[model samples]
Target: MSDELDLLRAADPAPAGEGPWRDRPLDARAERGLNRLLHSRRTRRAGRRLMLRAEAAVLALFAVLAFTFSDAGSSPAVAAPVALVVHDAAPPLSLDALARSAEARARTAGAADGPHRGSHLQSWYMSMESGPDAAPPVTVPEERITRWNADGSGSELVVATDPRHPGRPVIHDDHGRWRTVSDGKVLHRKSYPAGSAAQHGGLTARTKPPTDPEALRAHLAQLYGGADGTSTTPQLLLALSSFRQEWTPGPRETAAIVRMLADADGLRPAGTVIDRLGRRGQAYVYDDPDGPDGASDATRQMVILDPRSGQLLGLEITFTKDQPDFKITAGEVMSYEAWLP
Candidate 1:
């Protein structure tokens, strides 16, 4: 029992090259949270052997989780960290013009009357298996839905099912350890807390996004930029993750964001492709480096968009180099997500 837990003693995610969100450190408070998560009763339950490994695997994953996702005692187990993908070189297209087209379509449609409509986010997120040095990886196909009420309350529900089994979702027991159950109808859920960031970065009513491109750029820079106060590719990626993650955006805002992305560094047109939801979208590739050494652990992040309607279709990420310690092969998808239409 102590031997299996030795893996939990890891202070940093092994193979520094593999942990993606390397921007921050795990502080003492976060460490205590991990301790609680590891020592929970469910880790020793009879049927949760696989679940125990998963909880440890997730610890390996979040060791480098940014402070934004980690609270003192309560840890957010539901964060998809930085990601990228590696694929064929693409011919550059007039992404700016495409963004303009989408924006015009949004203006024509006008503002939606109520909260963003109910939409489901689906993805194959990478999950790790705790091992000797680095953890072995598995693809967790997850389904997510976030909804806002007319009275301004909302909830996010996430159901992760093993692709091999398909219906059983990986869940956490009352003791806060991961468990897999046979019920297809059961799901894990959480609600949006007041004053915290909204899923996909929706600003409050007082801070609704300006539809103009320049203004949108400033907004993102202020919201997602780094220490030097400049917006980088990674910050923009986080901005995209926080604000537009599968939730429907206003057409003008969508158009503006698309234009902003078109001009952002490292975006290359990957041409039109089908998303996991089977929707056709134009793809853009962003290879972001995580460490000071140029190109070390650089990930290829593919963001799919429906240019015609100007909606973001989904995002996928993959490692670009060999992570031998973790047994991670080059080009293996780290995570993938699509919105159900």
Candidate 2:
């Protein structure tokens, strides 16, 4: 991408050359001058004379323009930057105000409110290996629903299925980190290794929801490729891992996304229809941007739109990078979805 931009910048046309004689064509004069200079070996003086004439013509033009546009005898000067006294009256945003603003922006941008309405069934799969030889992969599946109460606070009920214990749902928090309540007793408790609790706590304290989908997409794209530059499941797992971060929606950013979607006339219709998946979300795939080698990666972006009001649901990024030899590794899908309270 950077290379392509550099190439475009380099292709700009150069300025036209100036030569002797303000009104006369320079082709005949240059041809005669070149032949004389080459044969007589007097190119330096001849070149200087030609340049002096061109400079004089430029000076004459500048003088004419200056006189014609003069307001007085003084020359025009650039104005200095003026510092204005801005009042410190701007108020800090309250949590309610932020939420309302985000909601309004989402509405204006045509974000549907469906995902927050009905029950949602979400399924996630992840696999990671520490070395070339490691234990078998781990898989997790979940089903959930988004329910809002009269007080505006909401809770999600998640029932996870473990392959080893089929049919028995392992109820857990929306985060999939804690076991859910059953019969008022803590039926399951997740044990963290020493120092893991501090790390998890730190993550919670520092995490803030992203309002910018573009930034989120860029982040997912980077993670999907992995830290060690390996491809495949690592990228996919990284994409899913983003959900752990809280999604704080920003009004202005959401509105901008909506306007782009509403005005997408030149864009080709996605090969796949934008349909609802996992109960109350709509999905659509689009082409990926060209990569470093001026070639488009086998990457496709999936954006989930809110099924209720058609607002942005979430974003999924998938792309493949070339591996050694002629083998091409499969890309992973990473995504972030909005969390409702």
Candidate 3:
């Protein structure tokens, strides 16, 4: 086995005796509910839920993870680190206004063609266990780079590192135990052979997303494949996030996405703020009163868009209320994705 896999195998996810929360009791029903929510494909695709399968105490939370690459090391280099910018209390900019501005900008921009060939992303993902033998939540910070050539060849690289705190130990799941590993570890790296059509991007079967606002909406709903033939606000956000993973939408597609989001229920503009990448963007939020599972809503979903180009800069999911069962505090981030151009 490779050194990285060997190290991963040596670590455990639930190290014994980490804290008091580890010994807390959870009934089977709640445990199953939490598990069902966390591992569901829709939620998992957006990094909206923690991937850990241990118990009911788990909730995905956020942290800012930044990385800087060095030419001297075997670890691959990446763009700058990700910084979590707190939502500002600026005047609300209506989604309608933002959408109009985006449409206007798209009209004036030069024509662009074809689906995006790759993506650059930085994110922080968390997994926690609350019951006996459970360890405190482990936050994993990663930088991923993907590229696809016209010939259908592509490569994917994922590295575990947080340059914001150089040399700090990174905790990872080593089997069932939580263990600390060195920073700058290359967790996964692979390249697709040329002329391989099986690894293409965009929605299933189709390689490009429609640019018409209604078409885009239906496109997303169809990809969702729910019984009602429609997507929830959370599901739409997750769908867009998944699309972004494979393709970076150009001005036309971006404008359509902005318009589509404007029409989504409960999403409202909050104000203008500088994104983590040091770009100014309009912020919109959706705080559903009823959580996805129909319980009291405990999370808020936020999307940031570049006002000038109307492109998405990032998406954040955060705790809106404290969950005593999961030991999560209000305002704690659940997960975040910073998409790079």
lDDT of each structure? 0.53, 0.32, 0.57
Q: Which regions of candidate 1 are displaced past 4 Å?
A: 1-93, 113-119, 129-133, 162-179, 183-185, 190-206, 226-229, 245-247, 289-295
lDDT of 2 at 254: 44
Clashing pairs in 1: 84-300, 84-301, 84-318, 85-300, 85-301, 200-242, 200-243, 201-242, 201-243
Candidate 3 structure, TM-score to reference:
0.69
* lDDT value, residue 165 of candidate 2: 36
Question: What is the C-alpha lDDT profile of model 1 across 187-206, one tens digit per residue?
Answer: 56767655433332223212
lDDT of 1 at 118: 46
Candidate 3 overall Cα lDDT vs. reference? 0.57
Question: How high is each candidate's TM-score?
Answer: 0.62, 0.31, 0.69
Instruction: Give the local distance difference test score of model 2.
Output: 0.32
Model 3: per-residue lDDT, tens digit, 111-171? 6544566788876654444444344344556678888777778888887766556677664
What value of lDDT does candidate 1 attain over all alpha carbons? 0.53
Specify the highest-TM-score model's number: 3
